[model samples]
Target: MHFVTGGAFHGKAKWVMKTYSASRNMEGWFNLYEAECPETDQFETSLVVLEGMEQLVKKVVQENKKGTREVLQKKLQSWLEWESDVRGRRLVLIGTDIGKGIVPMEEENRRWRDVSGWFFQDTAMAAERVNIVWYGLEQTIK
Candidate 1:
């Protein structure tokens, strides 16, 4: 599995798709969040809807606060199912803009940044490879 992430509008999904398309391997999965709307596409893609960064963070926080190995395993299982059923590939790309810096507002914005950071970290742990995009450049983080 591969996890590609970076700040908002940093082009992480773009780079991952380009790389995936260029790969000689015919079998692979691509899942993108926020970058595209969640509707069935002919091509393999899983789009997760979070509404906004705040909602996304809240989900992460709630998950973490309720931490359990079983819960983590279940999350991983769900991801794998998407890869298999939706994308049909052992190699998978889960893309998101989880590295965006904190937004200075109230508890909501701060919580978003913190929760997103943790989400990225968890994704990286689950992925065999992790890439961070900056200025259209790809840097391996794992």
Candidate 2:
């Protein structure tokens, strides 16, 4: 598992496409904003890219009416099932750094940001490699 993250519009997608030579194969891109998230079995490729993951997690938090710790953990565990669908040896997860900047005034919005940050931290811990792309430069953190 590889975690690639940076600020908004930091050319993360471009870097992944270029670095992985994705144009050579049919790369699967999972967009979080879609009405229905793509099923893992729907994709077959050498590279599986989960884009807008922050949004996906935010949506999950929003949908969980209880917002309890147990509920959150169960939701996250279900989401992690995608890890099984990583094509070949690559599963590049791209998330926006939501921890930067000021805290939100709305409690719900703030919780979304906090949960997203925690997810990123945990992903970095488990990832075999973590890369931060800033201004088109790559920095390997782990």
Candidate 3:
């Protein structure tokens, strides 16, 4: 698994697309911004690019208030297992760096930030490669 993160509009998606030469017409490119994550059986491409994970994390945190981390972890583990199930198959996750800057006053917003941070941390730990993009530049962190 590869994890890529950066501030909104920092070119994370552009970097990923260029790095992987990915396109929407590709068989297995799943950008969460456009559609939902596909099930393992439905995954039909060698590479899967998953964007907008922070929003998914926010949804999970909001819907499963008591088990947000557990649920996200489970989903991560499932994706990792699927990636490992076949040689050459890869999972590329792109998330916005929403945890930085000023903290939100709303309780729900704060919770979203906190959970998204933890979720991103978990993904970075599990990922074989981690990167941060700034101003359209890529820097490998893991």
Q: Highest lDDT, which number?
A: 3
Candidate order (lDDT): 3, 2, 1
Tens digits of lDDT, candidate 2, 1-142: 7888999989887888888777423557776656345555664665677778788777777887555345545534544565654535467788889888999999888888888887787778767788999898888899
User: What's the ranking of the predictions by TM-score, best on top?
Assistant: 3, 2, 1
Q: Which digits, one per residue and each the tens of the lDDT, describe model 3 over residues 77-137?
A: 9999999999999999999989889999998899999999999999999999999999998
lDDT of each: 0.52, 0.73, 0.89
Superposed model 2: Cα runs more than 4 Å off: 23-27, 66-87
Better of 2 and 3 by lDDT: 3
Instruction: Choose 1 or 2, whichever is better by TM-score.
Output: 2
Q: What is the C-alpha RMSD of each candidate to the true structure, in Å?
A: 6.5, 3.2, 1.2
Pairs with steric clashes in candidate 3: none
Per-prediction TM-score to the true structure, in the order listed: 0.57, 0.80, 0.94
- Candidate 3 C-alpha error for residue 39, in Å: 2.4
What TM value does model 3 have? 0.94
- Evaluate residue 62 in candidate 3 and report its C-alpha lDDT on the 0 to 100 scale: 78
